[model samples]
Target: MSLDVTSPPVLSDVEELVPSRYAVRIGEIDVLVISDGVLPLPTKMLGHNVDQRARAAWLNDMFLPPDAFDWALNTVVVRNGRQTILIDTGLGMDPALNLPRAGQLVKRLKAAGIDLGSVTDVVLTHMHMDHVGGLIVDGVKEQLRPDLKIHVAVAEVKFWESPDFSRVDMPPGFPDALRAAAKHFRKEYESQLQLFDEEYEVVPGVIVTRTGGHTPGHSVVRVASGKDRLMFAGDAVFAVGFEHPEWHNGFEHDPEEAVRVRVRLLRELAETGALLAATHMPFPSVGHVAIEGDVFRWVPVFWDY
Candidate 1:
C-alpha cells in the first residue's frame, strides 16, 4: 500500500534523547546518518578465528582499544527534492535484547528535519530485527508511518516469513530476543510489506539492487542525482575491514556467497567510483572505496554540515 507523504505515521509518547547529525551532502542529495544508539557485540562474533594471541594482536594492530566491541546503530536518511526516504530503521525498544538506547529513530528523524509523516518510503535492506525494528512501535496498533510504503526484498520476505525458519536451530550465542523478533516480523507484518525482485525504483532516482547472502533476499540502495551517487550497502559489508574485497563476515548465512558478492560489489564500486554507505562502518557510515593492490580500502568522507 502506498502512503501519503504529508500525513504519514504518528509516534506517540516517543522521546528523542539524542540529537541528529548530518553525514555529508553530494550535490542536491543531503544524507544524514541518524543514531538509534550503540550495541556491545562479543569480539568473537565478528569472525571465526579464536586463537587468543592472534585475536589480541589483531585487535592491537587495528587499534580497537580494550573493553567490549561497541557498534553504532546508524540509519541513513536521504532527501531529494520533495521525497524523504529512510533506509533501515534502527533497533526499537526491546528489553530482551538489552538495547538501552532503542526506539530513538523517530526522534532522530525529527532532529534531521524529517517529519515521520513526511517520509515517502522506508526501504528495508533485509528483515533482521535491527533493520525493521523501527518500522512499527511496540504497543501501537498501526505503524510509525501508517501511510508510508515499505519496500522489501522478495527473497528476504519469503525466508523470514517461511515456516522453515522456526525449525532451524538458533546459532550458538544468538540473542533470544532477536530470534523472536525475526519470527514476529515474518508472521505479523508480512502482508503490508511490498516485495521487489532484482532491481526496482521507489521514486525517480532511488533504486534497489539485489545483493543477497547476508540474508536470503538482502539488497542495497543506490541513490543518484546528476554525476553524484551513493550506495547504501546495508549489511553487505560490515566493519571497515569487511570491505577488504575478499573478506566475509562469520555472521553471514552463507559465507562463500557472501564473499563472492563482496568481491563483485567491490569491483563494481571501484570501477564506477561510487560513494559507499555501510550500516555497520563507523558513525556517518559513508565513504569511498579505493583499490589498494589486491584489496580495497574504505576512505571515509566527513560531511561539512
Candidate 2:
C-alpha cells in the first residue's frame, strides 16, 4: 500500500528546455535549489476555509487559472565543509496521482553533478509524500551511502503511527496516499533515521528545528553562515501566505496552529532579513519576507545569473 516504487526510465535534465536548477551561496555555505517539477492541484486547496470567490479572485489577480494551477516542488542541497545535506526530496513517481511533471529529483541531481553517495545527511521537514517520496524511488536507496543519516523529528515519527486526517481537507485519495508513503518510508529507512527531539545541528551552520504545524512533527531548517542566513521553511509558509496568512490551506493537519506557525516564521524572516525558501512556492522559491503594518509581502531575490 506504500508508494508505487517502480520508477520509470530516467530522462536527462539537459533534454528539458527550461532550467531546472538554481544555485545560491549563503556566506561560506553553498546552497542549491532544484526544481523537482510541479504539481497541478485545485485552487480550493489553497484555502478551504474561505469562500471560493476569494480564492478565485486571488488566483485571477496573480494571472493563474482559477480552477487549477501548478505548485512548484522545490528541494534544497546544502554543502558545508565535509558535510553535504539534502533538505527534502520532492514528489517521486506517484503513478496513481497522474503527476508526471513531478518526481524529477533523481535525474536532476545527476544533472547538478551531485552523486547520491556524496549525500552524507538528509534533513526531512516532515514525512509528507511529496517530501520523502524520492528516497523510496526505484534504484535510489541502492545508490545512497549506507552510512547516510536521515534526520527527522521524533514527534514526526510518532505522529504517523496513527495520523489524524480529520483536520485535513485533501482531495479524494490523497490522505491514504500520504499515510502509505509515510509508513513505508519509515519502515524502509528505520535504521538510518537519526531521531532528534526538538533541534539538531546537522553541521556547524545548518540546523533543523521542529516547528510542528502543518503536521504534528513538521519542522524547518535554518542555515546560518557568517552574516548570511536562509530558512528552508518546509510547509510552514506558502506563496499565498504572505497576503492571506489567516486563510487555511487544505493540507494543514492543524489549520489554527498552522496559521500561528506561518505568521511566526514570516515575522522572524522579515525582522532578521533572512532569505526564505519553501516547498510549494515558485520554482526557485527563494525570496525575502517583507512586512508593511500588518500585511506581509514576498520579495523575490534577483536571480543570481
lDDT of 2 by residue, 222-256 (tens): 99999999999999988899999999988999999
Residue-wise C-alpha lDDT for candidate 1, range 189-266, written one tens digit per residue? 656677888888987778998888777788999988889888888877766454343444545676667778777777
Give all candidates' CA lDDT scores. 0.70, 0.93
The TM-score that candidate 1 achieves is 0.84
User: What RMSD value applies to candidate 1?
Assistant: 8.7
Q: Summing lDDT over every window of 10 consecutive residues in candidate 1, give the lowest-scoring window.
A: 162-171
Best candidate per TM-score, number? 2
Root-mean-square deviation per candidate: 8.7, 6.8
* Candidate 2 backbone clash number: 0
TM-score each candidate.
Answer: 0.84, 0.95
